[model samples]
Target: LWGVELDPTSTDPRIPVVLSKFLRANPGDFKAAETSLRSILVWRANFDIPTLLTSEDFPEELGENIGVIRPKDVKGRPVVYHQYSGVDHKAAFGDLDRFVRWRVQLMELSMLQCDFLHADSLLMIHDYAGVSIFSYDRYAKAASKKTISILQDNYPECLAVKLFIHIPWWGTSIYKLVSRWIPEATRKKISIVSTAETLSVLLTYIKEDDLPKIYQ
Candidate 1:
């Protein structure tokens, strides 16, 4: 129903405000709680998880994958990885060959999620490449069109579903580039969504109730 753009830096600022407000407003909606926690879980994998809150250090490598750094500290200074908090899916799939397969697999799953969503609770997704999730390889316009189409066909009640997509303005170019390369079916699905309306829907979900639980 809503997505809040939170600064992964200072969790104190918006997480508490938005999360607490949402929970209080929707007490019985356990799905919202779980959905919120799922997002936090991804953040924790990269950064510290403060009571289910995430502190994102983007454009950096994750600790698990970082290497080539010295073992000893230099004069008591903290050691840091060059790519400390970033998710390069390209690296995960091994090499070029595997990456392609992985992308295709992910695209298929995305299609499935779009087509066969059968839950009473709404589905909320955030991030710059929420749509780009369809075409991991490149932003093929056709792929984006297909993603949009699947979504439109499956998700008849977009405005009613508790979905929130918080895409950063900066990533728009990359998103477009990735989206443009997608097949037409996916592209058609993306065309229906207006960025501004998505933001509005997310903001509405950030009620005063959800804010309190996040701080604790």
Candidate 2:
């Protein structure tokens, strides 16, 4: 899957790498791994994921600079960044369906860049410099739930880490809102960074030269 040409018998290296993710996620349950793999494949067909890679009709939220995949990190992993600073949440996510679609598309785009053969996963960074822990409204909450569910179900083992930088003192609330949907295994991969150490902590995984100007 993920646009690779592989038959059931084909020994494409990407096949094992991708399937191993499911196997690892299921933890020795081959049947569960098969089900998850089939489900994700079906999801791709229903979601028309292939078209998204070429379609220029991306959601308008993309114009708001809310999410982007930057260059690779020090380990050559895709570095995906999402910044909520100065964003008008109502305008940015007014259309829940479109916002969720964009979120999926953006995530898939980053995933496509991963080197499955070499073991690459995305390094996601969310900046909350101008946002608050209580910023999520009913609309945002609903969309977040649906979006997180889809990603967790269809894109298992896709993230290396999820870093929340530029967080305020009360940022723990963001965790409560988001952790409801995230599985315990994935939740352990998240980190809420204080404003003072945002750059320092990020530089450990990323090259400072590749970081966006905001972080610098």
Task: Please name the candidate that would achieve the greatest lDDT relative to the true structure.
Answer: 2
Model 1 lDDT on a 0 to 1 scale:
0.35
TM-score (all chains, Cα) for each model: 0.28, 0.93
Model 2 residue 60 CA deviation (Å) reads 4.0
| Least well predicted 10-residue stretch by lDDT in candidate 1 | 75-84
Q: List model 2 lDDT by residue over 175-216, tens digit each.
A: 786798899999989988999989899999988889888777
How many clashes (backbone atoms < 3 Å, residues ≥3 apart in a chain or on different chains) does model 1 have?
Answer: 54
Off by over 4 Å in 1: 1-85, 104-126, 129-164, 183-185, 191-216
Q: Let me know the TM-score candidate 1 reaches against the reference structure.
A: 0.28
Q: Would you list the C-alpha lDDT of every candidate in the order shown? A: 0.35, 0.82
Model 2 clashes, total count: 0
Lowest lDDT block of 10, candidate 2:
56-65
Best by TM-score: 2
